[model samples]
Target: MPYDLKHVFASLPQMERGQSKVISGDPKGNNFLYTNGKCVIIRNIENPQIADVYTEHVHPVQVAKYAPSGFYIASGDSTGKVRIWDTTQKEHILKFEYQPLSGKVMDISWTEDSKRLAVVGDGREKFASVFLWDTGSSVGELTGHSKHINSVDIRQKRPYRIATASDDTTAGFFEGPPFKFKFTIREHNQFINCVRFSPDGTHFATAGADGQIFLYDGTKGELVRALGGEKAHSGGIYSISWSPDSSQLISASGDRTVKLWDVGSGSAVTTFSMGSGVNDQQLGCLWQNDHLLSVSLSGNINYLDKNQPTKPLRVIKGHTKSIHCLTVHKGDGRSYIYSGSSDGNITRWDSDLGLTECFSGKGHTNQVSSMCVNESEELVTCSMDDTVRFTATGGQEYSGDVVKMDSQPKSVSASGALTLAVCIGQIVLLKDKRKVFSSDSLDFEPEVGALQPGGAVAAVGDAEGKIHLYSVHGSSLAPEGPLLEARGKLTALGFSPDGAFLAALDDQKVLTVFTVADNYSVKGHFYGHHAKPVTLCWSPDSEHIATGGMDMNVIVWDVNDEDKRIKMPDCHRLHHVSGLAWIDAHTLVTTSHDSTVKQWTLTY
Candidate 1:
């Protein structure tokens, strides 16, 4: 491998309204795991930005839990398949796989010995399954539920017991090596959302949509008492996590608040208010050692501060949708990567600090098609909402000033004080943040565009595989030369940092570099991608070009030598590379439809 993966900013867990998300922490309390799309994400508890992704699952994953031994992880998917894999290695080798049920596997639990497994979810025939972890053999009959089971748990100590919560508003308890359904306790009036056994195996708790939490004897399944009088919260409780000592617990509710309860006194201790918006509803939580974490409906993870309940210690934020475009900017001796997603959300990341924050104020309403940084350190972006926006990167806020294009923009470019935008069938030029020229009359349809760093010319590629050169005259563009032809329809175009060369990629999987001073003569024609290339970026030295395509590959082509190229295959598994940029000559940044931003170090 010519490049090493230096950092990965993983995506947030996929959230759904009225559904409970599972966040599992390792036994050592160093890391936590969650599921988003078909991939399972694991991150360090202390530094949430340090992350890893497991991409072997063929279906969307629902939950992932680490074994008590802390050496392996068992993740379940929508197809009811559970895969147990080794966690000590970077490759994450699969240890075993089994289809325990016929439908979605919502939750999973392992016994104290980490030998037996209990899985529960929405199955057609059976709502739950209990089996041996090493073999696909049944160990118990998990029955008595007439509807879908929402959560399941097994005692972490001796006198093994299993518990499950279901939509039937009842909690089931079982005990034995070959666990069997003992009895069903009908305590809640609405659907039960979660069930868990305390770490000491002394008590178990169940929370429901009726805003009630019932404590029961872990061994006998006997109801002991209810927390917070008759109700624990104003809205439905989604999840709960018990303290390690089994004396207190925290519950996350739909009312956008998480409350700490004292089990011995049966009263609320402290309430942490998330927010008042709909996206602020708390969905999941985890108690690992001294850390208390909760996930909101907006996919933001909050670290609870007991001393100050009003403000969280920190909130980790990132994109929850597929990223479409990205750009790199250097200011104050620090590099920053800005990414835009399909949901009109933009996130800025500090490359050195591994910190991320989203832009505030109303911005684009649709997919961000293209982005580039101008000399003024402003991020110039064009979106499918038929507008081009200029945002100050230092302030990290939208400027509200927008330039409305005549049609939906496909690409945007910035050079000094000049900005160019290519629309569906028109072209627009802007100066000083105001539109100065527009051209709706064109013989060819433009698909992408680029601007020379010296603000001398604008290169626009058409749908018919032609590169149309236009010289910049004040704020308008005038035709410069004859149309340069390519092998297929043009998909991406870019000018080098020194404005000495121009690179273009086409649907035919061909990359062509043209020398700027030689009458736009071809410098080299390179071929590497197996599929159509969609995005391209030039190195700071203007000596190399990198292109990413639908083939899930990124190839860096040396302009001086056509045959000298480095290819990174399967850069983003199960998704296409959507954007590319360079923080410096050796540092490359890539974004994909997987909603992740990866930083790589190129070794020349």
Candidate 2:
């Protein structure tokens, strides 16, 4: 176990969230954007990125606030989905799906006692609600808004007062059990995007699309004074966060800038501008102690300290895992990728920022056979446990039930949003179900070894010397299908570049090509390689095919010329090849069962 890894790129800072940005559903809340798609949620300043990633909304529409106890977080999304989860384990303890009309969820706030959460979003029947986190029970009602509610704040040391802002150009103050609307102040002409109460519960502030910032007395809910006028922000203000000392407030805006305001005097203290470009539109901001964190739509998370202005301390990248069989989304990303190991752990990688987050928060019971990304971006991984489990992008776990499989999964592929898993010898299709594809008998007893996708054709190779090719009529695999038969157990199969031919490699070290259609006619047989072939891959252009064999050599074949097969020199190669993939015409990637994945710069 000599330090297992062969090579590593850079040593990433082990922050709490592993380089994922946490975006707010409300465009006005502070969006924590990281370059690599990793983020940590922290408060009080010393360790802002150490807090666990707690929630994810459908459209990322609202702000998530940590309860006073720091044990739970209340999060809301654009679809009116609100979830409260535990902080330590990051488990979903409560879920509220309010259905009616979906509007942007602007903000969520926790009461002083950490018992009730005030949730505000765009809705027709209601604009906001006060709910108990433990049981999903309603505690109070939301009132006094003629239009969409934009922000909410509850006094932590309260006389139990709540404040909110709205697009209807007003801020509302309320009092509770059946929290009734107390007062409404019509002051701004534009949408109010953010409102927050100070830590001492003495005062509050509101910022809006009108480029106005106002201060109010938290206890009486009286307008203290206007901090800035139309000249305050060049564009609409999106988010505001209070500093830990309750002395400063930071605001982010579409103007591509972040402003730190002195709360007491109602004046601008300092300004941090990224640029005037549209890509730098600051959608959200947060004061994590001594540092300010802001997010832009272009996926840039800016970290600015009160003292330093030159460089960001760190940046995270993220890519969502492309839905696959037997995979779980671990951290977070916009683009998705999937990684499978022989031991069965399948980690989802966010391609948006190029970071690999753990697949599932919960450990897999067995080797993962296949995985798929559902329409909801939830990763579903099927393992030998005869079960399928669903995990979110942040590694949040959902209860998984066992699916009775006739045998272990051999090959699995997902198309048209459905997962097709071939286990033992049966081909089963599952759509939003774990047990939907289990069958007593369906096809030849063969273990699926390879899967190839091209146009309307999907090819699956099994252990029993058979290749099943089916036409995709709609979503279902054509009932009448069996594209071709191979000479030996089909170890590898792939479609040629133009979809004109199919290639299959057997354990007997033979490569065979056949026409994709017309009864799958044999095109040619190319023999003369190692004693055994293990893996095969085609370049991005499909002009070249590369194969790795047990003889520990990589052979590059000229697909256009059968007479010229080039065996690249292995004088520089040392590892036993287990996996092969061509990255580009001039680059290749390979992995070995010896626990190593390597990239090679092709000379030819």
**Candidate 1: Cα lDDT at 565:** 87
Q: After superposition, how far is residue 369 of candidate 2 from its true place, in Å?
A: 24
Each prediction's TM-score against the native? Answer: 0.98, 0.51
Model 2 lDDT at residue 441: 57
List clash counts for every candidate, in order.
Answer: 0, 48
Residue 187 displacement (Å), model 1: 1.2
Q: Give per-residue CA lDDT, model 2, range 387-458, as digits (tens).
A: 555555444344353345666665554433455666666666665554443434556665553333433656
Q: Could you give candidate 1's per-residue lDDT for residues 82-121 as a string of tens digits?
A: 9999999999999999998899999999887888889999
Candidate 2 Cα misplacement greater than 4 A, ranges = 1-63, 90-104, 308-604
lDDT of 2 at 163: 89
- lDDT on C-alpha atoms for all candidate structures: 0.92, 0.59
TM-score leader: 1
TM-score of candidate 1 relative to the true fold: 0.98
